[model samples]
Target: MLLLATVLLLVEAATAVSPTVRLQYASYEGTALANGVTQWLGLRFAAPPLGNLRFAAPQDPTPEYGVQQADEHGKICLSTAGGPPSNSSDEDCLFLDVYAPSNATRNSKLPVYFFIQGGGFNSNSNPNYNGSGLIMASDYNMIVVNFNYRVGPYGFLASEEVSKGGSINNGLKDQRKASQWVQKYISQFGGDPRHVTMGGASAGAQSVTLHVTAYGGRNDHLFSAVASESQSFPPLRNVSESQFSYNGLAIRAGCASSSDTLACLRNLSATDLQAVNINQPFPGAQQPPLYMYGPTLDYDFISDYTYRAYAQGKFIKVPAIYGDDTNEGTVFAPKNTSSYAESDTFLQNNFPDLTLAQLGKINELYPVEDTPSFPDSSRFWRQVSDVYGEIRYICPGIFVSQQYAKSNIPNWNYRWNVVDPEAAAEGTGVAHTVEVNAIWGPSNVNGNAPASYDPDGVNYPIVPLVQSYWTSFIRSYNPNTYRQRGAPTWEEFSGRNYNRRLMFQTNETEMEGIGRGQQGRCAYLVGIALGLKQ
Candidate 1:
């Protein structure tokens, strides 16, 4: 009892420093911005999921006093080989950062804009996803939150045995745990627990949609609104279906020989775990396996297919904004395909469950030619690109929006058409991740636009325009009510306006409605996605 009491006392003594606001049992120090924004970096929301906690669900951090020096960015979860660049990766990396308005006293109550970074559910870093620039761009009274979550294998490993032994979706659960923590602690930062708005791009956007549809719309009141950019809801694998991936990874890591492989995995060093699992392509495989370290239907956090949940009205009903980029296929489109035979082989290999008849229909709908496709003569490759862009991005947005709109929920849709001339690949129009440049505005850290431009960088007019809509949306669930003069009144999506979308472009020098281009593309792709069930 003496030793236990001494340890507790030491912990309390280590973190007893005071700040403007105080957590339930701890205190934090943050950097004050020139504009009076108080910034906190690298705050722990949960205990480090290291050692035995590696693959386990996140546990709450010890709530004791210690001077939490939230000064520098924390380490990110180890990344996969193809993931975004990371400064460093470590098991002890579950942390969050925040930016609060200067006027945010402990008594102040401001709406919160929480963002999740996207890297195909494979990689993302808290430092790269700073919310300071977002605050600066919006210049609103809203508070912003940024954080790191596990990705790839350490975060998502699955099998029946593994599931029975513990649980899956550790990475996703990490986000939920962090949200729960926010509900408990954000008030200290002058953020209202009742008015949290969640948003993200790509995989991060996908996360937002999943949260909306999680447990059939079970609302913990953690969020009041959602915004997704280029969100995709691919079919998730069941534990039975995920076993092959788990076994293969275990065998490769030499954990299969152990009687308790899951335990063996937990015993292995984080580096060894990643060395064997990270970036190891399937042997002679076409597409990566569904259960290979991505979100799966664990039946815990996610009850069913996200689309099916939307279709069945099984998600939290909240106002939302969804958007995609035009020419999304150019960047992710398959390449080096010479003919239909090769394309057929690729699909058959990637989607083994797809029958030849269905594949043939898909091919018929997306016929290819030797026609030139921008910067190259490989026009035939558009077959795959067309389908990929629609299936993974465009259609998914329309699919979810249609379902939610039917329920009379206010939904907004958009297609970002602006492309950076020098940055784009030959023939590829506005590819993925372009809208992010517009949303966060230009940053010296990761600037994509050419140096020398107006306040919004080369993104100019479009950047400022987009920031207005986003900040407005964050402030009042609607982006159209308030904005700069001459800005197009953003339209709300509904069944009547199902086909229309806000088209953001540079040439038009203004946003416009896209009522006809690529008409029926999303409808056809939704059909294909639904047909997959049968």
Candidate 2:
């Protein structure tokens, strides 16, 4: 009798430490952290994209036979950055992680935050994001989800044959599949499928925008709200235009001689193929953009340029929050540019189709000036950085918010200018993705929090304030309801005198407006958005 009691007690303790949930495919046992957050890491949401399934849309996961331990994260997807494959990275990477309050049950019906990580569509950087802090900050009122999707040529490869045999935009399709899985299975994890707020940063933010405007504004009822930071609108090349990339990769991979190149490419081992998965020069461009593999216009998944689609109001009418850091382009802009001619050359390299007249007009709009407002290593560097930031990150954010306001959709815009002491000292003031530490508390960030958000650091105070606003929006489409005390009310973007934005700073977060000069600059860019293929 004593032995039986001890065995029962051990089983009970094990069950308590590892909570299990059953879905259609399998039952997963999650780890219970000390902070009262239960996380199920690396739960497969779709089958591995391998063999003939390479470059194809994600398919449902095959059913499992028994309870599987979901303690460790899945391997990251192979990247086009070209490094040796390890146990941590593989082609069979299509898994997601979920974080929820340990005390919550299916009836909790908590709100959900489905976050996507950004890596310029070349690498999977989802490991950097941890949902524990966000869940704790929400006071256990919400669940957070983050996942890995295919990247690089494995995800975005396109060609005429690929269009006929497989689908384009496999990366975007992977995101959609993950969202659908949330809708079908989140309830089992104590989340409300109807209240999901999809969000991302950089390339991930661009993915959010694409999903909003996907299928020419067809709403799949996947998400009810959006939160995009530094949303990007790169040129959307047609599938035919991507044949250059396809042909180059195929030639390098020894598949050019095969009559069935697609099949030949698929038959190559992951390691052998990854050896040659590199970015090549795009057609008509001497140098490729930082991201060579990206969303292409396939007519089925993406019907038009994102800018044009938004102009036609071809986007889901959901409440949203759109924002960008002050110096979004410092990291991506060339530093050696010293003259107008060099800057013009830089522009041509990125947008090779730009006519000489357009280049001249752009130079006039952003003339070289040595002023405190545009401080950088050099005058021309600052000039080109401003131009790059506006065209690539800032203007797209403003344009999207303005379009949302024009359509009477409830949306808020903000500009992040909190000076990180380290970054400021390095002259990359409030550069791209610096706000991520503040958004996810220091405790939850993957590593030691940056000096900016350290306890005694410069930008530490705004952590809770930012967290509350985000959580409030996730819980109830409006950020103002549960905002931190004394935080200013974030006014909705309006089509009035000017589209106002909330400026986030160290201790002073306030509302501001889109100045007339910026408005004019963005107007010109939007006017030629189609010409730019954006």
Candidate 3:
């Protein structure tokens, strides 16, 4: 009888250990996402940012209820009403998702990629970012992560009211906290903490730039590499000015007075507080007004401007890949309405470095002969869009590349110039978000289709190539050796004189000149965009 009972107990233990069931994670008061080879979603990283924690840095996720189901994503970060209502948001919005090869429970440590979503700075959530394309293209198992940071005033408000009490740049603080969380727990989900790569596009890309160049101290040795798509660097763009200088914004948000700013603001309802600063108009408010609440170059987090920091070689030396899509500015910028002479005037006045001869060469290459080429009353809009994208995104990206190249760091650059005329007629082309679907695969979200842009219908030919290169870089800190083995030999950046950019022009792939003289032309045009160097 003793032997029989022992045998029965052994059988029960064996049954409990099924290959299909990996582990269960609890976050958000007991919510769970079953971990295994297949897939899991909505794993909490921090506690809800509600009530007393509304405007403070996010706290580590704590269990509140019994084992909660994490099979589906949680509600998104709260967005402004009337726009797309975010589903995976809440005051407790810090969470991440996982996707493995259905049979990923093997003991080997796999490469991980933590994604940051783009919505200028004000909108977009991580739950909307999927990982199919990235996983399917390489053998490296992906731990695609997404988390919510405070948005608008509730998260970014920096008033003497709150600053006096030591609360500033709560949104950025949340990002740092999320990276810390990944370092502590990602391995439990089958990811290699030392082989992680953090990446994103647009605002997300900017976040990646910040992480590598400014917030490196917060990563705690979690990520091995970094990649950014369509990252921007505007004139006078400094982390310090953006974060701590809330003098104007504080008054606009009615939190100017330090005496009781935090107490008074904290007492108000979430919605009411969000409205306090709505009347204040910010520059570049048409898109991503969230920049109003971004991090400043303060001692608590960042110490200087990102570009200046990079130039001084104070950033992390991890291998990085940065690129921009074709016609990127068309979607983000407003219509053109200035004349060629006006554009010329703008450039000449701002970028004194460029002469009339050089400016004329730039216009000739990009073309501004026929004003009607653009429908707007003035062709200046087209000039601004093209020039702005080059100077703001492309030039800055390349500037970083040049610095990396000079430092002997592995840096790869690409320009996605493939423009679907059909997409462009509707006002969207290889816009900012176009490459996302190809990188992360198709998401189930509704508005995936921008009003003027089609989904491209078919899979992008270079999706695998790009994804493989990225994963390889994440795993080995070099894009040279991809998982699938065979891939294009991507070259490193060598400056304008010997420029070469991996140009993805169609369903077919190829590499070509780095626009030869176009890079210089773009730099000159940037003078106009920034009202500097013209």
Compared with the true structure, what per-residue lDDT tens digits does model 1 show for residues 337-378? Answer: 767777666554444456678777777778775334655537
Candidate 3 or 2, higher TM-score: 2
Report, for every candidate in turn, its global Cα lDDT versus the true structure.
Answer: 0.72, 0.86, 0.59
The digit string of per-residue lDDT tens for model 3 on 271-344 reads 56545444232333322332344444555456656666676787777788888886666664456446666565
Could you tell me which 10 consecutive residues in candidate 3 have the lowest summed lDDT?
27-36
For model 2, give the 10-residue run with minimal summed lDDT. Answer: 370-379
Writing each residue's lDDT as its tens digit, candidate 2 over 1-534 gives 999999886555343233798899989999888999999999999999998899899999999989999999998898886675688888989999999988777667889999988888888754636788888888889999999988888889999978887779999999999999999999878889999999998889999999999999999999999999889877888889988888988999999999989998899998888888887766777776677888899887898999989999999999999999998877877876778987877776666677889889989998886422334466677677777888888999999998999999999999998888777766667788677778888867676467869778878888888898989999899999889889999999976624899999979999998789988998897777789888
lDDT of model 3 at position 214: 61
| Candidate 2: clashing pairs of residues | none
Models 1 onward score TM values of: 0.89, 0.94, 0.79
Indicate which candidate wins on lDDT: 2
Model 3 misplacement above 4 A? 1-37, 80-89, 215-219, 235-259, 277-279, 282-291, 336-378, 443-459, 483-487, 494-498, 522-534
Which residue ranges in model 2 land beyond 4 Å of their true spot?
1-18, 371-376
